[model samples]
Target: MTRSVYVTGIGRGDGRQVIELGVMELLTRHVDRVGVFRPLVHDDGPDRLFDLLRSRYRLTQPADSVYGMGYEAAGTLQAERGTDELVSHLVDRFHAVAREYDYVLVLGTDYADTNLPDELSLNARLANEFGASVLPVVAGRDQESESVRAEARNAYRAFDSMGCDVVAMVVNRVAPADREAVVERLAAHLPVPCYALPEDSSLSAPTVSQIVHTLGGEVLLGDDSGLARDARDFVFGGAMLPTFLKALTDGCLVVAPGDRADLIIGALAAHSAGAPPIAGVLLTLGERPGPDIMALAARLAPGTPVISVPGGSFPTAGELFAIEGKMSAASPRKAETALGLFERHVDTVELTKRISVLKSDRVTPMMFEHELIERSRSGRRRVVLPEGSEERVLRAADVLLRRDVCDLTLLGEEEAIRKRASDLSIDLGDAQIIDPQTAPVRERFAERYAELRAHKGVTQELAYDVVADVSYFGTLMVQEGLADGMVSGAVHSTAATIRPAFEVIKTKPDAQIVSSVFFMCLADRVLVYGDCAVNPDPNAEQLADIAIQSAATAAQFGVEPRIAMLSYSTGTSGSGADVDKVRKATELVRERRPDLLVEGPIQYDAAVDASVARTKLPESEVAGRATVLVFPDLNTGNNTYKAVQRSAGAVAVGPVLQGLRKPVNDLSRGALVQDIVNTVAITAIQAQGGTAQDAPSGR
Candidate 1:
């Protein structure tokens, strides 16, 4: 049976879309196939929430299959054909989606339309009819703490009285100071889990694009990323340039008469100077600046949105103030904000257990990424990023902090990191910043390094200078247990990132050599490719150790371990030194661990394709279903992983070093923000004991 979660709001202004999107994220983390169904929707062009989910979560369920009926139609049907008939039609449409997915996230009706007098009752009835456990959201936008608690209790009771399986209650849009009190009060009264999310001003602040849509304005400048900036405040221009400049604040939209080129130029110039980065400039009174002025404005603030509207300044101010920011496909940053807020406040593990979605048989790339984040959060550990000054690292740090995945210590000059983060408009909340040059801990780190390397070196002076380097500082931190792990190489070479680890952390007692694997996330599943970034060449014994470590690493993650030792030949079809090496490695693996599934001297096609396996090595269990592919050498492994990554569009998430004393990972120099985030999460998870679970059959 397909499990379903119905996210229903008690009334308007509840901001249930946050709850809905959060639930969708949690669902995708555990299951491969999750569906979204809106039982009732407004006739407003298109459903923004569903579009956001489809784009953000990469939903394959067609848009036509997601919605049952519009509000007007649903109301008409209920009035004419009775509630039972109306629900029956909706249930049929819902099951059509439910049957095709592992879990269905049913979006309950929005209370925007006033014609539906008993909207809560209708949502409850629909949830019951669809056999979904209810996750009700209550609005607390302007309510007192006691009032909000009362409403949450009443909402839960109302759903329970309706015979709906009320799984949790989410009190959203509450005042930030009142959030704790609201949750405490509700917890005492409610029978199920309760999550109270403090209202985020960003989620409510309008974007430049949203303001444009609201006023039917013309965009004279800006890119998509610029227009996505939140309009936190609206600053109307009427004074002199200097006087008006002082009124500017970060993310404020500058509003003025279109003829006021002085104000426009001043605002753009100030924005260019980064005194306070304004969202955009809004021109009103049915005018646009002259071409010369507009061209100068372009140079002053390139890619900053300069919008012109026909309405007068006063009316335009009203419309801009009324324009609320919405989470949609175009504004992904807001989705990240929503997910971050949701994850921080809610106990997702408990909620997911209550929702009771079955574990998926297939793990898609998105699922794997989601699981990495969730697992990191379960037992949070501190992972330091040595490349703290890098933009990608800062952005990834913002995401990690927002999602509350793991504690972070970024190594760099504190002032430089803060300035860079501010320039990027990234909020690095509570992330510890350490400057290796000025940090007081550097002295202690130097002493420790000298003690550890005294056998090779003679003086503490050399160790002091060496520990000043960011990579060495980070590695020493890990060795001394100041931090759990470290992720670097975003702006450095792979050797610069991992060499300090080999020197200080060293390999585990049972391991002979350290190796690495890339979690090759294909379209449908994840595969582990070993020694892609570490070893250049290996003898039979070292190759066998790599395969064994790779298999253990694969099983540590959710990927099942069926070891594939790659060579130029399959079975006895061809013979070479390379084939002989792989053949011997396979025998060594089998001799050491008979419990592990092992195959070698196998061609790539035979290791992956069932038909090729049947022809080449019939009745071999590990021939075609290999999840852990151990290449004969680094030359083959590196090129193969990169080739597949480019041509097949796979997400290669590692060079995760196994057999280390503590968890430390390396990133590619061209790593994106998400790649860094995943690597950091992998480091944190590895720090949390990296235990292997029972292997399930691979997809």
Candidate 2:
């Protein structure tokens, strides 16, 4: 039978979606197939929670299957057929979905616009009838600590008194300072697990995209990515440009008359130079700057959003202030922050045990993504992005800071980076920004570089010039115990990005060469594809070393290594130099690490496809279930990964460089914001001893 969890709240403003999304994350982590059902929803618009859950988890269940009745229909059914019949009909619809999935997440109704009486009792009765464990959430925002504690206990009692299976209690949006006392008080009194989540403004802050959508504004310049930037505060720009620029805050939305061209250009210029990333420029009073001025603003901050609203500044400000940010599919960064916050505060082990759901063997993409963030945050590490001025890198840095995933240092002109960040309205917080051209360590680093390259006849002058490059400077930072790791190549070539590391950081003692792997996140599992981004053609020895290194990388990220040495032929069925090289590599891996489960001279199909494995090499352990696939050469590996990525629509998360003394990875020139974030997280984990050698401390 499928286990069911009904996440409900006593009233409105409880922020219960956090609990719902958090529970969905936990369920997907343990089981492959999880379904969501909302007993009733508003017909005025799309269901935000359901949309987010479906899109984020890639749920295959049809939209119509997710809801039993809309609010209007449910009210009519209650008036005509009575409450019992209304619930009974909804119960049938819920069961239809429940029977088809291993676990069903039932979202309870929001108390908004529900004219029905005794809603709390109704939800409890419905949960009992559905035979689902109840998880009650209480809104603790703007409440005293004692009141928050009482409300939490009262919520639990309301569900328990109705004889509903109350599994846990969550008090959300409590003041950060009061969360500990609230959790302690609730846990002391409640029979079940109690979790208290502190108030996180990021979850509630409207993004520039959300503001634009809400206000029906026209996008004058910024692209969709910049539009998605979070607007943490709305600053009115009614003063002169100097005063206005001074008032600018991180992630703030600038509200001024469209005629204020000076303010507009100044804001965009400040953002371009990385003052603080503004959310966007909201022009008011039904007016707009002339094309000439608009052109200058666009040039100042290329893709930063410039929006025009017809309303006056005051009315627009009122509308924005009243607008409540929602959990939507469009704002995935907020969803991630919510998940991280929930995971940090809630005891999933206790909640899962209470729910008693069986674990599934498969790991979903959502699970893998969540696991990456969770692992990276366990022991935070410092990571430097050399191409800090790149749009994708700046956006990713915003996400990394908001999630508290790592300590970051952006290697660039501090003033320019801050201006860009301000224009984007992204708050870098304590993330250090350095100018490689003027850093105090430059001369010292140049001298050190000269000493290290003395055998190659490198002079101090040449070393000084090379150290001026951001990549070389960042690598020196790592070498000199300044940063933990580095992730570059958002705009730089791979050779340009990694050459500094190759010269200074170099490979570990145990590693014969440096290689790379892509964590191919498929629908039902995460597979490791190696040498896809590095090493052109490997002989047997280098191929074997790549296999070993790839296996270690797989294990570090929690994938058990079942190495498959890929070849055009399967198990000596064909003879050629390529197949022979793979055969030799397999033998060398066995000789080096006999305990590793390995199968070699295997065709691509046999390595991953069960039916093909049975037809080709049935008895081999690594034939069908290989988690790590080491290709014979880069030509085949790179092409195969790209093909699978494009055709199969998988998220390939690396070219994660392995065997470096310190964790330094490269990004694709076309990398998106999320790709940069993932690569940085990987780099941080690598720095945290996710690899063989522990990252040297103080670096």
Candidate 3:
């Protein structure tokens, strides 16, 4: 039976990281269930705190971070001084997630001053609410006895009143020489377990298999510690997605990037509804796991291992990733990261066995489990395809509004809108439609008729009539503050779509120009090619800016920026106006931003071909490989990029509108529904605000 065990702590110092790390450490040892509780999350958002914990413990559930999480109001709320309410609320959240798991670790706040009375109340309350035991690890200058003993006594005295016997106070930060004395004193005086735990800043990762296999170890406690289970000469191997998923489908341990834990968590959560413990977790970051996560892991397996990496998650994620990724439904990364992940973590037999299980599942379920999890958790994406008829615009209006992509105001009559949608077998149940004749912007335009309109718009009635079309009304909506942005090029020319944005939205105060970027994804990476859709032929200054900005974007997306300014020749092999332009642009870029690594006047082969690059420009910053490619002209860039898009069978995800105050975009006249959906998601992500980091870099 799973019981919610909320772990509470009174700290040796700022118990935030230590308390969290300790709870996470304990979470790995439990076989039942667990949850995390904090009196207050300091000044941080409760959701953010939970997110950090979730990231650490490999939590991938679909609910918001706050769901199954308890929170206390900011301290200014008076009455119980907030801490009291926070404690009460945290207890509730603990019990909630606890209902699903076996234990919950409740950590106390780092109370400044000697607020022993309030701190005492909080711990006692935890025990009363969740029947939790207090684990007060007293930390000091050096887990010394004399310096920390007095505080330990006070902490113990506080817990003593609540029917707690001698309290356990583990001395923290002790000098090596003092370790023996500290533990001896605490054990002698304390009524309970007073074992001293040293600062384990870099403890080695121990596997269950290792525990089962070790020959000369003393079994201190627990089932595996009993020296009963047989050890294995197990080896992990393979780097196939199908095979990886098979190991993950049931209960097998896997390691992956801390960032991608959600991928693992989501899959395990879904599978656990039917199957056994899917696996343990190896998070490749120094992130601390959350209580909710401890609970989730316990639900799936007897216990899941949660370990943080030494260097960092980004570099260490290869341990188990490649093998498990093969089993994931979407297979987000190319096989390189996966294979590297698997080869580095476990050995051959384990890999082969995992693959066999995955292949067998393929025949049994005929479905990829990873994909189902991703689909269920993926937020719905929406876009405005205000075409077909006035009714079509109306039908798509509400979806646009609710998605918050842009507030849509359609141009049509209510009755006629319904009639047209009915005729076309469309649905318009959720649109905010207004007759263009009655549109406020159109009316204002009409009132200023003669002065702004052509000879065709002489009278007020004529002005109102001319401005009343759906296109005219949509344009008006953009002009007003009614929409964040708009995208309507389908059934219209690029001119029609762009003309409105330029006229209404206009450019930013200092934006001298606006350009476009095209993304090309090959087998291993996605390359960003720029200035293909905008600026027919840019001057050297503008070209330099594009190069600098594109490089910045590359850096943002985990790609090291190596910019290549491409021309037909390598260096001075050709002499022409175009070559001169490319040379000048490259020179200006280096001169303006000397720190930026840049190279140019290189042939495409020199820029992209490693061998050719070695021969022509071995010392160049970009040399053989560049993340951002700057072409000399639109003709070459536009045609080459389109050819790559078509022939490579690669996803060309953009002309993703760049340099926007807000992410207003334009849709291609002919785009599929998937295209529309992806664009909308990208736009929404942009609206959330992005730094250069969101840019797509080489995988």
Candidate 4:
């Protein structure tokens, strides 16, 4: 049976969309196929929240299938055909979606401008009929802590009285200072878990695109990225150029008469100079700057949005002030902010238990990524990123911090990192920034490096120069226990990243050699491909060691260990040195760990395909169900993994180095922001002594 969660607001301005989006994220983290249904939507053109959810989560549900009816139609049906008929129609539509998905996120009726009577009772009735547990949202804006707590309790009781399963209550938009008090008070009185979300001005602030839509303005200039910026404050430019420039603030939208060319040029110039970066410029009174002035403005700030409105400054100001930001398909940064807020404030683990959705056995790429993040958060560890000044690294840092996954230390020049973050509009919240050349720890690191490399004819002076390199500095931090692990190579070479580790944090006592594996996240399940990164060629004994290490790494991250010794031949089909090496390695694995299921000299097709396995080597336990595939050589392994990654559209998450005393992973130089995030999370998990049995289960 499909499980469902109903997210409904008690009234308008509850900011329930955050909870809805958050719940959808939580659902997707555990299950593969999730459906979204909104019982009643405003008669407006399209539901912004639904569109946002579909785009953000990549929902495959058709557009017409997501909604039952608009508010007007719902109200008309309720009035003419009675409430029973209205609810029956909605329930039927919802069941159609529920049957097609593993789980459904049911958005209840929004009590905004609806003629329906007793919306709370209606929402409760629909939730009960849909068989979804109700998660009620209460607006705590402009309310005292006590009042907010009382309102939350009342909302819960109202649903419970109607026989609705009240899973949890969320009090959103509470004042930052009162958030703790509200949560504490509700926790003492309410039977269910309650979360209080402090008001984030950014969530409420309108973006430049929203302002353009509200004023029906024409966009004379700006890119989508610039338009997506939040207009935190409105700066009116009636004053002279110098005073108006002083009035500008970061993320403020400047409003001035289009004829005021001096103020316009001054504001754009100030923004270009980075005195205080404005969101965009808004022109009023149906006036526009001359072509030359606009060309100059474009040169000043290429992507900055310059909008023209037909109304005067006063009316435009009023309209702008009245406009509030909505989470939609266009505003992804806001969705990130929303997810960050929700993950931080809510105890998602407890909430997931309350929701009681059973974990799926099949792990998709999304599920694997989500599990990595959740596991990293369970036992937080510090990870160092040596490519801190790199754009991808800084962006990943922003995401990791926002999601509160783990503590991060970014290695680079502090000023340059900050400047780059500012230019990119990325907030690297509280991430430790260190410049290796000037950091006080550099001297200590140099001394430690000299001690570690003393046998290699390295003096302290030579070590000092070597420690200045970001990769070595990061690896040294991991070695010296200053950081739990390090992830680098977004810009540096893989050798530059792991060489310091070889010198300082060497292989474990039981390990023979260090090797790397790429977690090949296919459409249905995750498979481990070993020795694709570090080793070029290995003897039979070293190949067996890599197999054992790869199995341990696979089991550490929740992949089952059924070993497949991949070769060009299966069974006794062919004879060659490569085949002989694989055969010997397989024998070594079975002898060393008699409990492991091993298949030797097996072709890739026979190892992975059950039909082929039956034809080639029938009755072999590891032939057709292998999860850990050990390649014979790097030349073959690297090319095959890349081939599958590009052609099959798989998410290859690694080159994760194994068999180190402390974890130090390297990224591809072309790693994306998400790849960096995944690698960092993996590094943190490695630092936590990652074990599949002890880690949180996605299944």
lDDT of 1 by residue, 1-699 (tens): 988999998878898889999999989887888999998777767789989998888888999899888888888888898888888999999999988988999998878864775889988998998889999999999999999998889899899999999988999999999999888888889888899999999999988888888899999988776677789898999998889999999889999999999999998887777677788899998798999999999988877899989999888877777788899988777888899899989988789899997777777788888888888888989999998999899989988887889999999988778766654556676999999999988889888888888899636899889999999999998999899999999988988988899889999987789999999988777899998989899999999999999888887787889999999898888888889999999999999989999998888899998899999999899898888999999999999999999999998998899989998898988888899999999999899885645222245
- Model 2 alpha-carbon drift over 4 Å, by segment: 208-231, 234-320, 349-352, 609-619, 690-699
Candidate number with the higher lDDT (3 or 4):
4
lDDT of 3 by residue, 1-699 (tens): 333223344653422343344444334322222355554454433333355546544443333322422223434332455555655665676566557644455555556442345565665666666665555556644444676666666767777777543224445545546666766676666765553444322111233333322322222112321121111112121334445455553333345444554545553453344232322444444454466664655554332334444434444434333221111111111111222222222222332232121111111000111111112113332222334253224333422332223333345564555444432223243445566666566778666543445555377777577556555445555445454345565466666656545544555553456666765655345577877877789888888877876665445433567778988888877888888899999999999889887788888778877888889988876878776888877888889888887897666655666654544566666665434434444544444443433222353
Query: Can you give the lDDT of residue 272 in candidate 3?
Result: 40
lDDT of 3: 0.49
- Candidate of highest lDDT: 4
TM-score order, best first, reads 4, 2, 1, 3
Preferred candidate (lDDT higher): 2 or 3:
2
TM-score list, all predictions: 0.89, 0.90, 0.42, 0.94
Best by TM-score: 4
Model 1: what TM-score?
0.89
**Residue 148 lDDT in candidate 4:** 92
lDDT digits (tens) for residues 241-264 of candidate 4: 877888899888999999999988
Candidate 4: where are CA atoms >4 Å away? Answer: 238-248, 257-275, 286-302, 694-699
Record all residue pairs in model 1 with backbone atoms less than 3 Å apart, i.e. clashing.
none
Residue 352's lDDT within candidate 4 is: 87
Give residue 250's lDDT in candidate 3 (0 to 100). Answer: 30
Q: To one decimal, what is the Cα RMSD in angstroms of model 4 from the true structure?
A: 2.5
Instruction: Show pairs that collide, candidate 4.
Output: none
Compare candidates 1 and 3 on TM-score and give the better one: 1
lDDT of 3 at 5: 27
